[model samples]
Target: MSRLRTHYPLRATILEGRFFQLSENEILHSISLEYTSELTRLHSAYSIPEPDHPRPEISSPSFRIYGTEYDEVNRTLVGVLALRWIHFNDYESFVGCQPNSVKLRPQSFNWICNIYRKTIKSNEDLFTLITSTVINDLGKAPSLTTDYAKLTGTDINKVNHDMILYQVIHHPAVAETLVPSLTKVSSEHKHDLSLGIKLGAEFNFGQLAQAENVPACLSGLKTDLKNNPRAFEMRFMEQLLDIAGAAGHTDYTCARKLVEPIFDSYKNVYDVAIDIISGNLGLREGYDIILIRRVELLQRVGWKRAESLNIRDKEKRALMRLLCIGGAASIKTADLYYQTFTAVNLSRTVYEGLVEGLNVDGSLEQPAVQPTYLPAMCGLAIANTANGTTGEKMKALTALLTYLSRVLVIDKDSLSFKRLPEGVIVVERDLRQTIQPILESAAFKHKPDILTDAPMPRDQVAKMADGYEWSFTAISI
Candidate 1:
């Protein structure tokens, strides 16, 4: 046997400034003692690996005890399961406590709760819990902070109120619920809900339309446009003419399909104006023509129950203008004229009969509601200047701009009215200039990071950019 070299072992440092010199064997035994305590802690905290598990088995012999021997084997598998459990519990707690009264499954609730209980405790957990609880409870629908506060006892100040509202509005289930509600509400409530639903639906529908592997019919249309330009152009123009003619029909059933919700909304406004005018309630001098015109138009459209022919031709003309502006054509106009002239304001109170039938705000109250002249006027302005003078083209262009500006936020540079070689004035406004600003402004005012620059597909880009352009011809001088 080789002679053993004598080397002194390093002293062990312990708590409380205690130190001890030990032989090699003594040092090995001391390490083993601490290792055993740690192993016990880990074993108690986590589920032990099953014998059938693929990982290497834990064995005491695998741990090195000294220069020559090994001791306890497993120490790394300590707090993993405990940490995972805590995270899951935290997630569940967040989902469970949502303030919006949105219902969630018990299984999901329990799963997240268990994870939180097992994971590390921190403010992050509380924050998630609060947000999730609020969103879930609110039916996953966007609501005013005051509304949410009314529903959830939690103070609105405690969380990012705007973000919560945006999420609720955009939530799929909430949006779905709201779309139908928009159609059902009485006229007063219609304006508020309809505008909100339209905005949300347009955003969501655009996303759905752009999804990969869209249905065959829509995809076929996309392909035809891309592959056969001449055929596509002819077909598109034909379809446009057909739709416009269909939209202009005077029969109520035929017309309603094209303008039901909007017309219904306007009817509410007309009713309110009539009430205010008739009751001598809140009537001002400047509004007399407006009120009289509204009453005549309502009656002529067969919207009222009684009549009076004492209404003058000037008033009739004003009423005709109002009716035309509201999109009722010749037949509907005649009906309105006949109805309003015969019905008494007191025969059936306009407010009690019509305004009261609405839900929240008066008919004219919502921002998104537009006069019926909007679309037709826009189309006519676009159609008339196809071969006109530059000055006439410019006038039509200005009219188009004015129309769009009324409904959308527009950038000055994005408005481009160009005279084509064929002399048609083409108005080309970039939709991005109109729409992006709105999205950007909303995002910046709230949580700015939500606005993203993800690459959009070509078809999506086209749909988004559509209607931002129109063509017209001016009168030859």
Candidate 2:
């Protein structure tokens, strides 16, 4: 992780306008003018030819840049979904107007460049990082909204934008921009660069884990580039640089404090979970694992309208507060649903209502909200809940586990429940074996007392059991 720097250079004066409308040649000229010496040095170091083909100009930049929009035209959602749309120049001038609303700001070409200069100090990462960031949000283009809807059968609100990006990587506009043919460029250079861009665009393990029944490599980029370790490294660098770039955006100390931990904990939780299942108790050769506590902050959407529409965002947060857990992966689509017991004064009814409401279909904001994976373990972290009673934590655990059983099929390993769209077979035994050790490790480190408490009712345990021998104090870590 990059150390927190007190001062960061502001926007480059050369990139001040709507450059996306310019021709590809003009765009390249402007970039070269801004970083003439740096590009010269990088091209020499990497032995790559300068971009020759005229790339496609970016169009419709307002898609997922701001979060979900629901108007009458979408047909699935009622009422208007209010989203923030501000120019890149406005974001450049943001000092401390509203720290909580940073996610609302969309990334313009200038914003991308500002972050890029701050984060990428190494010459080795220059070309891949630049290309990846440029085309990372191609799926967010409004020109592809109808195509996205057709691909997923869901509104833009609930679609996987990363998948959409991967799907259109070969489209004329996107292909010309990302994987363009050049006169003197080696095929390997073009192939590897294209692979790196695709890897960065689609390597969203967090979102994949959050979505039910989706494998970590559902987008096929991982399988495509599995043999290319350099491509994977480039993808990882892009993600790290992204976080580092955001950390430098403001002078606000609180923002740095909030993001610094996520930067420091570089190990992927999903990867660690995989290792545990493979019978490797040791940490990965070079990486040290840390228990990451992620808090889903409030989005700047229309609250009154969302509440009227019974949007599940607020309800999930309410449940998080009540359960007192930092983070949890949902067995369904309600990602990050983890807690131990009541952290606030909210009634148990509120917690119960939140859980019960989630069990029903077509009740929440999303249409036809159904559980995708059966016999699947919803990974939840029980931490920072030393304040709760043993009985309270136990009851909360029972309630959650029982609810999961109702939603996911725990009895049989039928073919329908076993197979995922990406051809990954999720063995029930492997999932049960995997989640137990990880959860136990997290609990042992964060809240040790719960391991010694008595078990929940036998009937409830049986209903929700994931084939792990039921025990209250099975502290494997």
Q: Pick the candidate with the highest lDDT.
A: 2
How well is each residue in 1-477 modelled by candidate 1, as lDDT tens digits? 011112221111322112122333343344334333322322222211223323222322223332321111222211111122223443342222222323333553353334334431333332222112112212222233344445444333222222233333444444323222222223433232323232221222111111111111122223222333322222222221122112111211111111322323233333333344244334222123333444554565565422542224443433333333333333443453334422352133332322222111111121111121233333344235435544433344343333333322212232121122122111112233233332324332332222233221111111112223211121110
Q: Write the per-residue lDDT of candidate 2 for residues 189-231, one digit (tens) a residue.
A: 4465566555433335332222322222222332555466555
What value does the lDDT take at residue 335 in candidate 2? 25
**Model 2 scores what on Cα lDDT?**
0.31
In model 1, how large is the Cα lDDT of residue 472? 16
- Where's the lowest-lDDT run of ten residues in candidate 2? 76-85
C-alpha lDDT score of every prediction, in listed order:
0.28, 0.31
Q: Tell me how far the alpha carbon of residue 404 in candidate 1 is from the true structure, in angstroms, after superposition.
A: 31
The alpha-carbon deviation from the true structure for residue 412 of candidate 1, after best TM-score superposition, in angstroms, is 41
Shift in Å, residue 122, candidate 1: 41
